[model samples]
Target: MTKRIVVLGVSGSGKSLIGKSIADTLGYPFFDGDDFHSQANVDKMRQGTPLNDDDRKGWLATLNAILTDNPSAVIACSGLKPEYRAMLRNGLDDVTMIYLKGSIDTIWQRHQKRDGHYFNGREMLESQFATLVEPTEDEALVIDISQNADAVLKEALTLLANSPTH
Candidate 1:
């Protein structure tokens, strides 16, 4: 059976990297949720302004549409809130959520090393952490991000392979 996966995490939690790895391993398409953001949202984030739920409504809807359209794919998204996750999972089934759990300091250090990204600064990272409503054990396969990327990917693949859908 085809599997639809959403790799969830705050910025710099390696969502894109892991999601892409999973997609490639499974021969599925990979989509970065950031790529779907509107120009205005991008500008807001670029300016170090955090986006409220109201600002994310349309963007989330578009992401929902993308998930709805693709039967078997992986997406890297910050499914920070329960409501947002629900919105993304609307009209979909058997969507495996993988949360890349990490501390602010850990992610912040990684964030600092990256370049040319709109989502920058410690404040923005803190805001995301403040806004994050972590998924319950049943809601997502939680993976620690302190380990190296290869270990995380291996663990995620193992978990996904054992998930009901797989």
Candidate 2:
């Protein structure tokens, strides 16, 4: 059976990298949530402005539609708040929520070196951390971001394989 996977985390937590890797391994398509954000939203993040719930409603809806369209996909998104996660979960079957859990310092340090991204360094990261509602034990398959990208991907795939879905 095809599974819908959401690779979620704060910025710099390797959502895009890990999600894409997992997608390739699973022979699924990858969708980066950043690419679907509205220009206004992008501008706000570019300016280090944190987006409120109202600002994300449309964006989440659009991403939810993508999940609906593709049964098996690896989607990299910052599913920060509970409401946002719920919205993403709406009308989905076989959905796997993968939360890339990481320490603020670890992510912040990594964010500093990243270039050509709209998300500003520490400021944007602080906003994301402040708004994050960490996924609970039942809500997601959590993985530590302290691990290397290859290890993280392997761990994720192992978890998926061992799951009842198989």
Identify the candidate with maximal TM-score: 1
Worst 10 residues of 2 by lDDT: 157-166
lDDT per residue for candidate 2 within 73-140, as digits (tens), equals: 88899999888998998887677888999999999888888889999758778989999999986888
* Per-model RMSD to reference: 1.3, 1.5
Stretches of candidate 2 exceeding 4 Å from the true structure: none
lDDT of 1 by residue, 40-75 (tens): 999999999999999899988998888888888899
The whole-model C-alpha lDDT of candidate 2 against the native structure comes to: 0.88
Per-model tally of clashing residue pairs:
0, 0
Off by over 4 Å in 1: none
Model 2 vs truth, CA RMSD: 1.5
TM-score of 2: 0.96
- The residue-level lDDT of candidate 2 at 145 comes to 88
